[model samples]
Target: MNIKKNEKPQEEQLRKIYTPLWQNIFRGATENQDVDILNILKKVPIFSQLTKKELIKVSYIIYERKYATGEFLFKEGNPGSAVFIIKNGTVSIEKSNKLNIKDVYATLISGDFTGEISLIEDSERNANARCTTNTTVIIIFRHDLFDLIAREPLLGNKILKDLAAMVTKRLKEANEELVKYKLLAEVKNDH
Candidate 1:
């Protein structure tokens, strides 16, 4: 992750290209601002309990990334280093396959979190994320999240519990969907 001195300038320039817009969003998250980003985040159930100050703090560690339509954010089975919070536009969650056309797993919108499985275990990603449209996302690096949690155990614990609940809920929903599909298939075959 350490870049040479010569690479630092380029890295900083790249960071600057996207940081301003995200900074504006974070600043708005701190105070009562009428920005669109604030309203979007306000609708997110997971962050509903977060205070403005805490939201701002969470924002500080976030980096903005923009992706063009059809660009793969990360491939399934690649090592994940950061999780993404969709700030704008849509992302497709796809499954890996040997066939030319991969399976479309799910679609993610603004406020949706991805790459969370990396936090629980340092393993290859389970799915691929591709930009379905021109997309802008807020990135939270795993290291930064870990460090923040380490610095504030109480806040960190709360975040972890929230994440756990989210994962659990999603799993249950998927299971229900699977059962419904199976039952429907059985009914059709019974005819």
Candidate 2:
């Protein structure tokens, strides 16, 4: 690396620009920190099968942050970029109705993840996520995962497979719930 008379070190520049994001997320992933993160990821269903080594690779790209109650992790229509895993506290997923009132569709807790679609697609978030209490979340941006995949195809492929399976399962469950709701509406109208 060449140093210019007027320029600051690259590391310094990065630290200044991304300080908050890195402060908690990238503190070197020390032995104790690695075990702590590995334990959290292990509890998450999508990453359940990843080996210790694989999880360590994944951990390098993770960013963890804490939010106060009522803060939004993301808003509906925001460009989706990362998947978030709730490490503690609660987050509620909501959407606006025709009347513009936000209706919460789901409340997520520890070990649950959201925004998985962002990992594979460039799309807007369909719902909003707001913390219902002080919360800690682990975020993995799509670009980071893709870059890792480019360098480690086997690991990337495994993550992609797991993400796909998780999404498919959720879609199926949502479809079932929709059917049940439709049936209930029909029954109510018949009376």
Name the best candidate (by lDDT): 2
* Candidate 2 Cα errors over 4 Å, as ranges: 1-35, 178-191
* Candidate 1 runs further than 4 Å off: 1-46, 174-191
Worst 10 contiguous positions by lDDT, candidate 2: 22-31
Residue 98, model 1: lDDT of 73
State the C-alpha lDDT per candidate: 0.67, 0.73
Candidate 2 deviates by what RMSD? 17.8
Model 1: pairs clashing at backbone N, Cα or C within 3 Å: none
Q: What is the C-alpha lDDT profile of model 1 across 71-101, one tens digit per residue?
A: 9888887998887767777787877557556
Local accuracy of candidate 2 as per-residue lDDT tens digits, 40-131:
78766566678899889989999999999999999989999998877777788878878787756667776667887788799999989999
The TM-score of predicted model 1 comes to 0.68
List RMSD in Å for every model shown. Answer: 15.1, 17.8
